[model samples]
Target: MEKKNNRYSLLLVGLAVLLVVGLVFTVGRSKKPTLNVYNWSEYLPAEIITAFEKEFGVKVNYDTYSSNEEMLAKLSTGATGYDIVVPSDYAVSIMIHQDLALPLDKEALPNLANIDPRFLDLYFDPGNVYSVPYLWGTLGIAYNKTKVEEPVTSWEILWDPKYKGRIVVVDDMREIIGMALQTLGKSRNSTDPAELMAAKAKLATLVPAIKAFDSDNPKGHLLSGEAWLGVLWSGDAALAGMENPDITYVLPEEGGGLWMENLVIPKGSRNPELAHEFINFILRPEVSAKLAEAFPHGNPNQAAHALIDPEILNNPASYPPAEALEKAEWLIDVGEATVLYDQIWTEIKGGR
Candidate 1:
C-alpha cells in the first residue's frame, strides 16, 4: 500500500507539470506580434492589410493622416511606436533633416529592384537611402465640361472672373501657393519672400472666385455640381472622371506641382524586422499592381505595369504624356524660408 501511494504521488506531480506547460503554450500563442503603419487616407487597400496579417500571423495597427503637415505635427508632439510612415517628397526631406527615420536595410528588400529607376534618386532622397517611392501625382485643374466650355491650358483659368464662387481649391498651402507662383512664371518651389508674398497676393485675389477650400473629397463638390472648377491631385481628378465622364483634368501650361510619396521606417520602430518585411511585401509586383488598380495614382513600380490592365496604364489622367511631365516641377524643402511662406499663408487665410 505504501508503494502504491508513492506511485500515485509521482503521477500527480507529472500531471501538474503538464498542465503548467499547456497553459504557457496557450498564452504564448495568443500573444501575436503587431505592426504600426501611418499612411495617407485610402492610400493602402484593405485586402492588402488582411493578406499581410494572414500570411505573417501578425496584427497591423494602421493609422492615416490627411496631409504630410498633419502627420508632421502629430510626430512633433512626441507620438511614438510607429513602424512605418508614408511621406511626400518634401516631407521626406524634412524628416531626413530632423533624423526622424532609419536607414533601410537593402538586403532585406530584394524586391526593391522592381521600382522603376526613374522614380529613384529623387532630389529629396538622393541614393534612396532613407525612402522608397510609393506613388507619383500631379497638382492640376479639374473642371466640368459643360460649365467651363473653354480650353483649360493655363492656371489663369482658376482666377477667371466668371468662375467666381464656382471654383474649389485644395486646402493644402503648397498646392494652392504653387499654382499661384507658377501662374506668375515663378518656380513651383519658390522660396523668395517677395515671390511668396506675390503669390499670396495673387491667391488673395482668387479668394473672391473660390467657393470652398477642400482637401478631402473635393471631387464630391464637383460631382454634386456645387463646384465647376477645382485644383486637384491627378488621382482625385481621375477618380472624379470615373464617376462622371464630363469631369476633365488638365495640366497647366506654366507647370503643375509634381510630387511623389515614399515609405520610410520611422525611428523607434519596435519591430524593425517586420517593418522591412512589410515593405518588401509591398514592393512585390503583384501587390503593387493591386494598389494601382485600387487607386488611380501613377504607379512607380515598373514591374507591376505589365500586371496592371492596359486601360489603366494608358489612362491620361493617371499617366500623362512625356511633354506634359517635362513642364511639371517638384516642390522642395526651402529650409528657413518656410516661415515666410507660412506667414504669407496665414495672412491670406486670416489665421490667428
Candidate 2:
C-alpha cells in the first residue's frame, strides 16, 4: 500500500511540472511580437517581408487590398488591428483628415533623408508628418509598336474610331473619368457639375472603343494582342513591356494622373515600434532597390537609384522625364464630387 501511494504522489508531481511548463510556453508565444501590415495587392515583394521578419524575430501578418477605398473602409471602421498601411495620393489626405493615420516618429526613421526631395512636401502631406512616400507612378498609354502607327503622344488618339474593339482601360471610375477630363483640359478632380457632365458625356462615346475594362490584368489584354492600345499605370506598363518587347508606354502630352502610395501607421496600431522599424527598413537603399527591381514602380528613394538597374531606372515609361510631370496633376479628393464620379461610372458601366 505504501509503494502504491508513492507512485501516485510521483505521478501528481510530474503532471504539475508538465502544466507549469505548458503554461510558460503558451504565455511566451502569446507575448511574441507581431506586426500586421495591410497594403495594395502585389505591391510589396515577398522577400522583403521575409527579410524583415528574419531580422526582427517577429511574425508579420501581411494582408492586401485591391483598392485604396477597400483599405480605407477597413481602417475607418476600426474593424482591423492593422499596424502598417499604404495609402495613395489623395487617400493620404483622406486618412489624415479622418485621423486614421497616426503621426510617424521621424527620429526612428533616420533613413528618411534618403527620399527624393522632389517627391516630398506635396499637398497631400506637408513635411510628411504622418506618411512616408514609398512608390509612385503615372497613368499613361501603353500600345503595341507593331499595331499602332499613329502618334501616341496625346489622349485624343484613344478616341479615334479606328481603334474601336482593340482598346482596354482600367475599370476604375476615377482613372477612366480622369482621362476624359484631362483630355478635355479639365481637372481630374473637377467638382464643377458642368465639367463632370462633359466628362461623363465623353466617356459614353469611349465605351464603344473599350473592349474590356480590367484593372487586374489590363496588361494581359495588351500582351495577348487583344488590346492594341489603352490606359495603364506606369508600373503595369513596365511589366507588360517585359512580357512583350513590342509594347511601348508613353505619358500623354496632355498630362495624366500622378499617384504616390505611401507607408503610414494607422491609428490604434498594436506595435508602433515595429511598424516604424519596418518603415525604416524599407527606406534602406538596398531594400528599396530590391523592391524597385521586383515591382518596377517609380521609386522615391533617390539613394536607391544607384542600386537599381539602369534599364528600369532609365525606362521612360517607368521613369518619365521631369518635364512630363511638370504638367501632371495629382488626383485629390473631390469632396462630394465623388458622387458625380460614381454616377458617371455607374451610368456608363451599367449600360454595358
TM-score on alpha carbons, each prediction: 0.90, 0.92
* Model 2: residue 345 alpha-carbon error in angstroms: 1.7
Q: Candidate 1 lDDT, tens digit per residue, 156-262?
A: 98878898899988887777888899999999788887888789888889987888999888999899999999999999999999899899888888989799999
lDDT of each: 0.90, 0.91
Candidate 2 lDDT by residue in tens digits, 209-289: 899999999999999899999899989999998888899898888898799999999999989999999999999999999
- Runs with alpha carbons beyond 4 Å of true place in candidate 1: 1-31
In angstroms, what RMSD does candidate 2 have relative to the true structure? Answer: 3.1
Ten residues in sequence with the least summed lDDT for candidate 1: 343-352
User: What's each prediction's clash count?
Assistant: 0, 0
Best by TM-score: 2
Model 2 stretches astray by more than 4 angstroms: 1-30
Worst 10 residues of 2 by lDDT: 343-352
